[model samples]
Every structure is written in structure tokens, then in C-alpha cells.
Target: MRRLACAPDTRPLISDRNHLGALAYCYATREEDCLPYRTARDFYARRVAPELPETVLTAILLVSPGRSLTRRGNVAELPRGKQWFDEGLPERLHHFCTDIAPSLCPTPPTVINTDGATPETVLAQVAGVLADAGLDQTAQRLASATAHAPRPPLDPRFVDTYTQLGGLEAFGHPFTPPIAHRGGTVQLCRLGAPHHDPAGHTRLWNPLGPGPWPPPGPAWSR
Candidate 1:
């Protein structure tokens, strides 16, 4: 079985496959505002869809409490010819939609109103459902990744760099969160073993500083 890995910073969502050989990508909105279908469709097409693997068979959008999945207009309906699902908490829907029936289900994915749940909570619940459905390996992988997901620093510049370089998996956790140093700010993160530097630290340059500056001290032999 392929181990489910953490979603990269560029995509703030989880992607995994169920035991039935169906692929799913789940996203939880950070804010409480509901997005219209057109906006959602465009965002998915431009930002999410391109990042999805060819194997993906469905897309799920999870939102927080007080939020809804609204149509583009009062009479507008969800765009046709796409396998999209909306739910407050994915685990709840898992029971009813065990089999992948994208082609058969003509109706749009159901819209769920999460009473008041956090993204972390939704992810944990979905992981549990996967475990119950005999996808223990995937469940464990998702749980582990969720637990160690990196928290972005407050600085917008650092956040941008982290997202660009890839999140926890690429840069590991921030050993030293963004902090001011040497007349500028710096963030020290440990890289994944595959890409860790000789010194075992990945130094992110302050976005506020000049461009293309070399490492402060002696450069490691590449």
C-alpha cells in the first residue's frame, strides 16, 4: 500500500486513496466565510486541480462552522462533469459513499454545514474513518503527518518562503521560528533527511533582504 504523505505547503489539503481504489483530495477552509460555487470552481480549477495527481478520483471541500457551500447565484447549480463533494466533516459522509460512483451520481456533491469544527478535528475524524474501513496503513500515515504538520510563522515573508519551498516535509519543522538577526530576520528549519544540508539546517533568507545572497559562512561542497 502506498503511504499517505503530508500535503505540501503549496496545497493545504490532504490527498489519499481508500481501500476501494478511489482517490480523494480533502480541503478544509481556514476562514469561516462561505465561497460561492463559481469562486470555488475557479479556485479549484486553477489552484487545486492542477496540483492533484492523475489518480485522484474525487475532491472534497470541508469548511468551518457558520460557513456554507453556496451556488454561484440563486438559481445557479454546481458545475457539471466533475466529481466534487462538500462536507463539514468527511468521516460522516464516508459511511454513505463507500463506493466511488462519480459517473453515476448526476447530482452535485452534497453540501455540509459544519456546526463548529476545526480543520484539525475534521482531519482526525477522517483518519479514524479510514482506519475503520480497513485502511489502517493509510490512517496511520495521515494521523502521523497531521500531528507533525508545521505551523506557519506570523511573518508573511517567512510564510511565503516556507510555502514556496514546501512545508514540513521539505523544510521539516522550524527549529528556530522566524526571528530578527543581523539587522534582518532569519528562520532556521531542519530539512527532511533526503535534502538536509551538511550542517543539518536549512537557512531561509529574509525576504526583506537583498536577493541571491550566499550563505553567511563557508559554503558546503555540493
Candidate 2:
């Protein structure tokens, strides 16, 4: 999306699939996801937070059930064919569609439920939602924000490392908002996930790697 905005004479685009949806689906599955909440948060921090004024999270709750029973395969005329939904997949989808997805947003997103609405109706509602969210003059807002995005706060524990590593340029900014993670304080930057462990050890998750790994420093080498 950002790349598109940079196209000469191109206008800002409306992105349908944002981190919000991906996070919701990832949570719904609850698998050993390699890039779950972390991916979503990074995107929010790097792109959405600075570019957009407001967010719109659409919930197509009806698809949860419909997906499970939908037809598939070549020609795909018969029910319970290819793409047969997994057991509990529907439930999880429904749960995410209705509940968990909305909670993760920094602010409550304006949700539009497209259970049984026509295309015209959905489009109209979305237009209203965009207007209410004050998303007018997208190009202007994006340009301005790029120049002066609100400085997201940093975890004090990470201040020294961030400074040494080259603050905004090398580490980018704090991707995740202030949130408690599993048994530790986690703050993600562009380069890595800096964690202040409850056991009093600091570690980092390599965002570019497959998973968490030791960071470069005298302390971690030990």
C-alpha cells in the first residue's frame, strides 16, 4: 500500500486486508504461528499508525458458517467438497469475527457487519464510516504524517539499546503499543522485539528471522 502511494500521480489506496484481519484470523486458529501478533503490531507501528487517521474493521460474520459448508473442487458444484472447513474452524472464525479481533485494535474500530447486505448497501455504509472517521484528504494526511508522525513511546529498558543501535533509523519506532505479554514486558521496534524478562534477563526476537534469537551485545553473548 505504501509503495502504491509512492507511484507518481497515484492517489492513496484503500487497503482491505490490514494487520487487523490477519491478527484476527491468526488468533482464531491459535496455531504455532511464526508471525502472529508480532506481525500485526509491526505493521500498525510502521505503516498504519503514521499514515492513516482512523481505522475501519469490517466483520463478515456470516462467512464463518457459510465457509464450513461451502462447495469446492474443480467446477465446485457440490457441497462438502474441496476446501472442506476444519472442525471448530467455523467456531473460531465466528469468535474472531464477533469478538477478539475488535479488542486488539488500539482504538475501537468502526465495524461493519456484512451478514446479509447487498453490495450497494455495504458500499454506502462504508462510505459513511469513512466520512465519520474523518478520512477525507487522504493524500494530504499521509504526506504530513510521514514528515511528522507522533513519536511513539519507548520502553525505558530499551532506551539504551535503541540509542546505541541508532534509534529511529536503525530500530525504527516502537511497533507495539504498551501491552503486557506472556510473563514479560515486550516492546517491538523495526529491527527486533526487545523483551524485559521477569527473571531479570533481557533478550531479543529477530523480527527478520524465522523466530526469536540472541541479539548482538556483550550481555547476550554470555
Candidate 3:
């Protein structure tokens, strides 16, 4: 007898009331029912085809609640072989499904509900939540990104470069704080550097640069 260990399904549960009507249609319908209309291969086609309607594609995005319920006792016993089990795989999958997938949607949903609160207020609330979770750096970055201010706690070397580029006033603002890229950390200023032309947008500042600023022109400008 062979024992098989399967990972738990951590997919979000879909409620009939929560999903759109078109999605609900597919979710409620059984795969066997869909097979009569379309083959399994055709139903799971990646690109839009004459056979696959837009509504069907949208419906495919919804998690099928039935699959979760039906998979309880079914397990495949594989022949003896080296099996690799990663404890962290489930958490990574959860992050991708819950966090990354939503963001990758054509129109990503808003972070918070749109109540009477202003955009600034909502951002502040998010920052506060991050701070409460002991993510001080993330909270600071969120606040800085929203305010369009210089990224706080700048390194000693970049301080002079930031001041020379007219700080927040002339450079517009620090849209992205310094983050590690390629070989060195780079910061993105909303306005281009002084050497670039008028149409130039987004100046790149890297502490590891041969000089203080990135090269002029579109190639190195981004």
C-alpha cells in the first residue's frame, strides 16, 4: 500500500451572492454539463477563440466552489519515487492567488472601500495598519509615495545629489524611493535631471553611479 500526501486547497471560497451573474452561472454548473457544450481542452483554452465567449472567459476566473467540496477524500497513490515537499509552497500560492492575481486583473480592485473618506485618508489608514503590523519601512514608503515627497532616511551620499537636483520642488517628487536594481540601488524622481531636455520624464539617481546622476537621454532616463 502506498500513502500519498496532498496539499490542502487554500483557494478563496466563492459565494453565489458575491460573484457576477455570468461567473455564477459557470460556478454553479458542473464540468460534466459544460462538456456537452464544449470539450475540456476548448473550455480551458488560453486565448480568446470563436468558440469561447467573453462571458465564459470571465466565468473561468471565478474559483469553482464545487471543486473544493468534491476533492475531500480523492487521492492518487503514486509509485515509490523521491517526493519533494515544500512547507512554504502553500503560503506562496496563497499570496499569488489572493494578492498578485487580483492586481494583475485588467482593472484591479481598490485597496479599500470607497466610503466618505478621501484618498489621502485611506492611504494614511493603510500606512497606519502597516505600522501596527511592525512594518515601519513599508509604512514610511507608502506615506512617502502618496505625498510625492523625498523618500525619507536618504543615504549620506544621495543627500547632496537630491539637494542639487532641487529636492522636491524642481524634481517634482520622489515617486519611487531608492530600491536595489541591477547592481546598485536607484531612486526615481518625477521630474527629469537638469541635463535632460524639457520632455524628459523620471530622473534616475543611483549612488553607485560613476557620477551622481544617470546619463542624459531617453536610454538611461527611465
Candidate 4:
């Protein structure tokens, strides 16, 4: 037992419920729902955390309320995979942010709210925090740095809407890269979604329009 504890190469065991996922369920509609999560949180702090590394930092991620509710509704409408969601998810998320997550660590946990953001943006915040904690991973930094890079070759309009308008920055950071759909290309960003036609003409798109994102195409069709 002494030799095993002295091992430097040991990796931390990860349990999905070890973190915020448990406290989240604690806010569910019933008292019975709270017990398991409360017990799990207590066990981890008492039994698991001591055996693990003394250094600990918790990073809590939250989605924007608008998107969270939208995705929640979307998931509910799916014909299958209903088990992953519940009507109370929004309330739980809110409670975690306002009530529970703030009091977690002796020092506050780094909380990043992912509202109208690309995966890279959210990941960048996490990587930046970990770097400060003296544990830096090269791949994660590279991923966040290149999040806006065009996957397939970029179209002229996809990069620059007009010569006088400078570049894609005017449309905000790229979310999904320029993807080939039907024949041309489509890309989504914070401000707009743009489409490139087969005829070398590009058209502006409203991503928030009443349809699948990236405008209508065989791939995105309902």
C-alpha cells in the first residue's frame, strides 16, 4: 500500500459524476432526487479527494440560457434518445450556477458560460485556466488556436464578404467551417451564415431562420 501510494505515474481515476453532474441532479424537482447526488458529492470529498492529488481545480461550464432551452426542446422532440433529457434541466442548470457551483472550491472554480460560442472558444477558456494551474496540454492549445481555420479550402466570399469590408471578422468567429453541401460551400459564424453557389456566386444566409442551419441542402434538409 505504501509503495503503491508513492508511485509517480499514477493517473487520476475519472468518474462522470465526480463533478458538477451530481450537484446538478440535486436541484431536480423532488427531495428523493437530491439524496443520491448529495451522498455522491459527500463521498467524493471524503473518500476520493484525499486519495487523489492534493491539488484540485474545478471548472464548471454552462451553456447560454437561450441555446440551452432550445436544445432541451430539440432533444425532447427527438423520436428516440429521450433518456438523456428532462423538462427540469433548465431549472437545474440555473440552480447550479446561482446556488451550488459558486461555493465549490476554497478558491472559486473557473466558470465559463458558453453562450453563442464555438467549441474552440469554450475550450480555450478551459485550457487557459489549466495552463495557469501548471498542467498544460499542447494539443488543446493548438485546437483552440486553430478553431477558426477553414477545414476544406475557403471560398472568397466565405473569407471576405466584400473587398471593402475587410475579412470574416466582420461576421464574427467561425463556428462550423466552410463545408461542401450540394455543390458549393456553407459556413456558420457568430453573426451570419454564408453560402457559396456552384456558379461561383456567394449569398448571405440567416442562420437563425426557421430551418436547419447552413441554409437548405441535401445534408441539412429536414
Candidate 5:
């Protein structure tokens, strides 16, 4: 369940029976709106794919909100004609199909459209995506979604830690810090199901683990 900010060239394909997921946000018109997206995609293909554990499941969300040049207001104007992509307006269609999809071995990448869905809907889509990827246990996935909001606050600490992992720089930029710093924030939202033993014992599951065993996250302690 590791999240890495990467470019298309470096993005890795999930090559095992593990459940995996990813989110990609692109601005169709303002393709240049966020240089980080392209950078992150490239990073994953080259550096991140090689080191992935064979048992890990992979999932990705590609969000491409069409770009616009209009400003929210004129009072805070910098350049009159300056253009920027609207924060969250356009719907994300299933675009940019990646080779990584077929690479998932037994599990395949599920492409979701963020066009008209709410955050909760999108999260649910992600859960379904992971399930289709062969990471069974959907009931737990629903429970995991309850513990937190659709969007989680970004933790800077996690970004820093991931950066230290070897070959991480492939995801970094020269003048700025790693794209993961920003993209990672969007990915910090924890959503998944709690792992339960056949005996009916509930346990915590951490999605961030590289292993394919039980998913990761805390269980409701009764």
C-alpha cells in the first residue's frame, strides 16, 4: 500500500496478487498546470516499480480536472491574462490508461471516473477498484471508510519518511522538494477495511505495508 509520487515513465506496474491502488490528477487543458503530476508518474515507472514486493496489490486514481484561465476574483489578481486550473470543477474521465494495469499479474488496475461522483463515491470506487484487483474482504473496506473522512489531512512526516527510501529522488525535483510532498498529501487519506480472523477476532490493518497478507488499519476495539 505504499504511495509514491511519480511520472508516467517511472510509474510501476503491480506485478503480483496483492491489492493496490493509485490516484492521478491531470488538467486536460492546463496540462502544464501542475508539473508535479508528470514528474511523479515518470518517477514511479523508473525507480519505484523495480523495488516493489511481489505480493503487493497496486491501485491508482487518475484525476484530470479540465483547466481554466479565469480567476476566482479580480481583487487578488496577479497577471490579468494569467491562467490557472480551477481547483475542483471538471469531472475526471477514464483517461491515460497505463501499461501498469495489465502488469498486476492476477490483479488488474480498475480505472474509475471521478466526473460526477462525490468524495465518498470516489473512495468507494477506489475500494471497488482494489477489490476487483483481487484483494477480497469488501465488508472490512466499508468499515475502514467510516473511521475517517473521504479526505485526510496530509502528514508531512510521511512524505519525509518516503523520501528517505532508496531511489526516492527519482520522484523529486531540483528547485522544489519532492512532488510527493504535495501529491502525497492528497493520498494520505486512509480508507480500507479492518482485518478479521476466521474465529471472529478483529484486528487492525495498515494499508501502507508492502506485504500482501492482511491489509493494514486499526480495528474497532470492543
Candidate 6:
């Protein structure tokens, strides 16, 4: 059974409540209700319409010390597929906005890079972007709500909207999209629900566990 995953934001109404509403929506609809890994694989084969919002409705930038980039092996390390995504995906994502999304929206995405900026600076930038996007009220509400947001331990599979606005170092590793799984023959797949094999789960979870991360770097850091 194919599933459609959405990135929340349904209740874009109440100013103070909307940001959390959107997050709850995304968490409930996309992460909890829909299976993104399976859906992405299905998308690869079928070339279906993207389940997430089309266009760079917003561009969330994460800036960190070059050390953070080295630490995370580059933000590109987060996207699924392509061995080179770790090296190339950031540019690719940028291109997607500049080249691909313009056809769909009058306004381009609002980009935020918090490489050396403070939280207040980051928040101001986010507010500016939202204001430019004609979402000032929404941005104001989010600014307040995010300040009080109770952070959960990082889940590498879950994308953090806050991280996109900078402060990734404080949030721990940013959770990214997971690689999709393509099961074997149709007959072999039916023995149980089509899902990731054991190895696939390991690859997906490796970044989150305590250990030496593959490809090697600092042996003493979290």
C-alpha cells in the first residue's frame, strides 16, 4: 500500500500557535502516520509527485563552524540516495529552489545561514524571511514558541526546522531524510510487510549510536 506523507503546517491560522501546530502536523502526518522510507522508494520507482510541499516555500539554512561541517561530514550527508549527496546535495538543494521552484511560486525561498551568528541574530533573520515571505505574523509566533520549545534527543531521521535556522551545534546532529528501501522480488516480499532489511536499519541508525562513525574522524566527540 502506497502512503502519502505531508510536512504538516495545516493550521496556518493562529499566529502564536501555528508553528507548533505545523510541527505537530508534520510529526503526526508525515512521521507518525506515513512511512517516509517506504514512500521515497516508491517515489523513486514511480516518479510520483513529491509528497512534501513543492517549491522552496521556505529555505532553512544551517550554518556552523567548519568543524561542524567536518563533524557531520557535510550537510549533504543527510539526503538519501546518491553516494555523492553528502558532497553535492547542498548545492543540489539550492538549485532545486533557484532553478526548479521558481516556476511554481512568485516569491523565491527565504534563505537563512547561521554559520557564526547568535541565536538572536538567527531569530531575527528568520523573522525577516518570514516577513519577506508575507508570513510575519507566523514568524513572530514561531519566534516565541521556539524559544520555549522543549527539545527531544536528536532522531537522525527527523528533520529539525529549528536547526535549519542555525544553532545546529546546540541541537546535536541534525536529523535528515532517510534512505529508501527497495525490497526484492514480489514473491519474497510477501512473507511480511515490505520494510527495511536488518542491514538497512543499521545504516540508518549508525549515525545516531555511540561508536566510531564510519569514514573516521574525531574519536572522542559525540
Worst 10 residues of 3 by lDDT: 76-85
Ranking the candidates on TM-score from highest down gives 4, 2, 6, 5, 1, 3
Candidate 4 lands at a TM-score of 0.47
Q: How high is the CA lDDT of each candidate model? A: 0.39, 0.48, 0.36, 0.49, 0.37, 0.37
Model 2: runs farther than 4 Å from truth?
Answer: 1-13, 30-64, 67-84, 136-222
The candidate that wins on TM-score is 4
Clashes of 3: 0
TM-score of each: 0.26, 0.39, 0.25, 0.47, 0.32, 0.35
Worst 10 residues of 2 by lDDT: 1-10
lDDT ranking from best to worst?
Answer: 4, 2, 1, 5, 6, 3
Can you tell me which runs of candidate 1 are displaced by over 4 Å?
A: 1-59, 64-113, 132-134, 144-150, 153-222
Evaluated at residue 26, the lDDT of candidate 1 is 23
Among all windows of 10 consecutive residues in model 1, the one with the lowest summed lDDT is 74-83
Clash statistics: count for each candidate: 0, 0, 0, 0, 37, 2
Evaluate model 4: give its lDDT: 0.49
Candidate 6 regions with alpha-carbon error over 4 angstroms = 1-57, 60-68, 71-85, 132-137, 145-150, 153-222
Error of 5 at 115 (Å): 0.8
* Model 3 lDDT per residue over 1-222, tens place: 001111234222222122222222233233232323234223434332343222221111222223322332223121110010122322333333445434322333223332455557665765664554455675687676654344545444466666664454444445555667787666655443212123332123232334745535222212
Which residue pairs overlap in candidate 4's backbone?
Answer: none
RMSD of every candidate to native, in Å, equals: 15.7, 16.3, 22.0, 14.9, 17.4, 15.6
For candidate 5, lDDT tens digit of each residue in 61-129? 544443212223423132211222234322322233354344532344445555555667766766565
lDDT of 1 by residue, 1-222 (tens): 122223324322334333211222222222233333345545555665566453222333344312332331222132110112234433333432433323212222322233476666655666665564455676677666654456644345666555654444444555545676766777666532222133433233222234554324321111
